[model samples]
Target: MLRYGDYTLSDDLITKITAVARHDDLVPSFVICQLCHETALGQHPNSISAREDNNWSGMTWGYDDLDPKTRKSGVQVTPGRKRPAVEGGYYIHYATVEDFLKDYGYLLRNGGFYKTSGAKTLWDHARGLFRLGGAQYDYAGDGSNSEKVFNSYYTSMKTIHDALNADGSLDRIDKGESSNMAGLQSLFSIARQYLNEQMYGSGHRRIVDTYNGQNPLPVGYKLKIDDDWCAAFVTAMSILSGNYALTGGECGVERFVRDVFQKKGIWLGKVRPQAGDIIIFDWDANYWADHIGYVESVSGDTVYTIEGNSGSPSAVRRQSYTWNMWQIKGYDRPKWDYASPAPLSVGGKSIDAIAQEVLTGARSYRIKKNTSSLFE
Candidate 1:
């Protein structure tokens, strides 16, 4: 089975699709979703478009009588006549898979579809494609009931995206051009200094003192002078190391650690090991993660870690463990948002209000084309 996020393509079609998309400058996720909707990833074994014409995107056959250069035709099949057949009418075809993608990309980019709405996310782009395809779906305002089906599509794609990301498949799929774990490198750099700092005295005092000076106390709890400083040490290091986002605003290690993984949708045993991941330990293998550390590195059969509470003095120590170590419960990889999403709130105005302001700024499309409306 081939994976594209969390969903499995169960075939090698995604490999070719990704290649074509990357080379053609089309968003891979959007194209994949369209293919999923159009042809079910070519899982319809007896599909006429898949078997006869190698077309899986349902591009329609066209002939321009006025201009010979505009003529484009495909091997047509009637609705409901064959497996994976179009329900409404005859559909288009292509000679090869590459040709299908090339034509589809060209049409999507040059046609009024992509030109109309400057969509940023894959879901929004899918909305545009749905509109262009005359699909019965609305893209306005988080999509109402008519467009609620779009949510399923978006959820599936996001599942796939997150799965692929957790499994580190995007790096391999993108030919190592993008590494999801690249953001963790800086965290390791920041944590490198305290690799072997031994805590004197009660050890908890130093940790609490260090934490208070750097940032304000977290919402609920005030730091006790002699509390177990392991969690506090981890939290302080995180804030100092520029990974404040994953801290989860919790003073406790277990709570924040769980929060990081849950919020990121990455669970233990679901993701591959990468440096700078937060490693929590279950000392007695009782399913309770009590101790936490930063993943230093992973070798072939062993994992190296830099932990805060190692000895009685409570000094940071570098430790190594084999994969079968019972104390190792699991690891949580920090979710780093490299690209911020579009601002939903702008200058204290709600997104709806801002959208209205935007709509008021631009004139509505009124031009006519081929007895239909020409979108601006």
Candidate 2:
């Protein structure tokens, strides 16, 4: 129960905020912060439009009034000015809060503010929203102008953001609950759900492959899918499971194994693998992964995995493995919390869990030589 001004934060508001954030792939904290700025968390007298007209984001009224969805004409009077008798004014009105938030999401998404500069942080998104409204202030600037008067509006919204984060009210949105995936359940539940769907075979491959295909290819990307689509299935499952940002969209097994897994340090030798870990395999022991799947369980020296493209129909199945199993190239584990029946250790000769390896390998090279040994 967040309290600000005269407004008590409701679950309905949170749900609408979450919906907009997920739909636009933006952070919900920033969206709500912007809403706080716009409506003053129901404090600003002008924000009465939210309750009276269901207009929450300062949207303007249209020319025609025939559409029932469009409510009363919006008006925003200055502190000293009286409300005009005309049917329209500066702000927009809506029939419902849902319509208002949905339109705000559309503005953020289709208006090119989110795409061009990117909204990676709460402040970045807030600044983007401010820019959308033609505000010239810096996103990270102190809340003071030349008059030395603090901008209470901006400072107040920022405080709201800080409070939400400090109290963990923003945790749900931060953890992808806006995307319907949150908590420890999210770390594995989505993948398990896809596995239960039992999507398998080349006939059903299109379902996952087409989903993975939505990602735009980088410039000069030439490799295309033509054969076994195990990687595609894995990548698609990750996207559908709401972990696409973590698993990535690589359709090639070798690319996913080397680029996504190894590059991110999630790649590990099949030592003490756990459930929710992605198992990549090479059919020929050539160090080139040709297939991938999710680890289901581990019993003694045997490891079980749910893999797509297993049998002749390319169906998904759980395969068991013994010690030193061939085709068991390595495992790629998501850095998330899950129910691991076996205890995970960090070091020693024991098969320590291997998901948190430090980032290594040089990003660039420079030429240097010893001056003292020039004669030698």
Candidate 3:
């Protein structure tokens, strides 16, 4: 709904970009902002890709992994008008704008560096622009996580993300149709659909892990990927259910609590939780929140939950806890409105939930710094 009414980039092209990027599970707005940055809103002199090839985002055709995916070898071209490919070939020439977009989406989605560069979330990508600048080009070759570099690229994207989503509205946020329980029921239902789900090294959860900029268990490893991904699952549920605006996503629980729940004023401390509240627990009663899960329902003194990274083999499963168990730290509730439940999966892809990013040590350096405010 962003009125790109002020830009010269045609609505058709922008629309195509959105459709293609989203089709591949890539965030389209970030892709659009990157295109604007690289091609000067598709008006740069070096953007012959934009003019002739319809490669509006400066995609090069040199990587071997990406080569086999495309039908053609690509057009021989140079970085600038006067320059030429060192030998005779290597810049991608699209047969159609569709071809270019398909390859572009494939590159970003499967590309080794984009996710690590923080491509999962728009602001996330700003952190590792050195690797992300141009995996082949290494645009920020100095390898500095400098504010100046971020200011240049991310600031431009910020200018475009409706002033950085100022006022905190997200794209898919739905207003309540009935009561809070209705939306909470929908959230629980969406999560319930994925119960007994296996934790695999490949699939939607693994992909979303990279998108979140968290290193996920690699495929083909000897181990069965038993890493703790509870928080990732919760975060993914938030996104898949269109509740991300209410339930902010983060890889670490400490960060989720301190940065999101607490910062957003959603951290309801030590209060009895209802269904749909995010519950935090402390196994040791040492004051740091160690585990997180969603409240399915509260029956008497027991709280049912759908937690990722639960049980013996480690998978998405349902469990119960005493409502006031010492391990039960507190709850953070999202303000929900009524709506129908979203499908647990999309296009055979989950897009966001069910991966438990490892909890290396919640009581480590991070929580040590943020513990003062919780009990206060």
Candidate 4:
């Protein structure tokens, strides 16, 4: 049993997270874990700086400083400080914990931190961020697997959570419980209890592709198409995986990449591309940007993609594509905002119906409105 002063380790953070979570009615533990993982308890100088300036991660403009507010904070790197720096190298700041929690909650809700709603429980969200989502401290280019990285972060988080939970420290300090094992179970129970009222109140189910004989979409679904297949593939995959949003409208490939930078404030181009990052292309030879694909693997200069809506039949397909063949347009980062999954509605009908509407123009089957609600 771990303890932090009068309160248990898990309890203290849980109370802190809950104070903010109430506004969104989501789990605060996940956010707390992420902050701990990202800033190392605000001990890192970069985290302190970034937090003060509303830049959760230290993403600076190259040469030119954009955003007058951030510019005033001196957010840009000092130049020639090496490509990537360690711990305090990337920091974003906020004035108060309330502000920090608000931004943190926003990131968890709409910034692409998790799959669309219900699919990822709070625990999964916390674990995922600690795993491959947050800023990478080590840049040695060691070929360690993502699973290994996840386990390492998860272990550290568990230790912190345990310390917070030992004697109900969080509850006494901030009137909330821990968000680890015991607390997670409670959250799931609460979510299930309010299933009918929540947007993604229904539980998440595994999406199956019936066209491919009910097969799960390949980890990196790919296919070859004559024209630009990048955008189509992203839209197709989102629908196939039940991650599409009809209300905010389906975020196309280019929009998706831009959103990662704009909405989430993540600096994808500077970071090393990982397995799930989206890779863009200038397929049409136009500078305006044309296509995109999810990176499946990268060996030397050759990269593979799990593309959708490409090749004959125009269905979700997988095929080998060369990295060199396409001009590099930067990486499409995943932010994993699952807390407040966007409501999908078009023409006054449910998003599922709208998905069907869009799919008619697409080569794949679209989700149907009220088709097998999962949570309830």
Which candidate number would show the highest lDDT if scored against the true structure? 3
Q: For candidate 2, lDDT tens digit of each residue in 118-210? A: 376654555454433334433333434512222444466678788666857777544433222232233244334334233343334443434
lDDT of the candidates, in the order given: 0.52, 0.52, 0.56, 0.40
Model 2: how far residue 301 lies from native, Å: 32
Assess candidate 3 and give its TM-score to the true structure. Answer: 0.40
TM-scores for all candidates: the values are 0.44, 0.40, 0.40, 0.34
Reference-based lDDT, residue 289, model 1: 63
Ranking by TM-score: 1, 2, 3, 4
Model 1 weakest lDDT span, ten residues long: 365-374
Cα lDDT of model 1 by residue, 1-376, tens digit: 3454333563244544654554444556566666665555655554557556667765544432212222232222223223233344444455456556655655555343343123456666655645433433343233445356656666766665565557655445433122334335544554555556566443334445545543334554666765656666676555433355554334566675565556654344312344556777778866666787777777765778877767766677888887446677776655532312123244665434533432333212221211111122
Q: Model 1, 184: alpha-carbon shift in Å? A: 2.7
Q: Give lDDT for model 3.
A: 0.56
Model 1 error, position 178 (Å): 6.0
Tens-digit per-residue lDDT, 234-279, candidate 4: 5444444344331111224555555433454332342234444466
User: Residue 106 of model 2: what lDDT?
Assistant: 63
Cα lDDT tens digits, model 3, 334-363, are 766423334433334442332122111111
What would the TM-score be for candidate 2 when compared with the true structure? Answer: 0.40
**Which one wins by TM-score: 2 or 3?**
2
- Stretches of candidate 2 off by over 4 Å are 1-6, 40-46, 62-91, 110-117, 130-153, 178-376
Which candidate model has the greater lDDT, 2 or 4? 2
lDDT of 4: 0.40
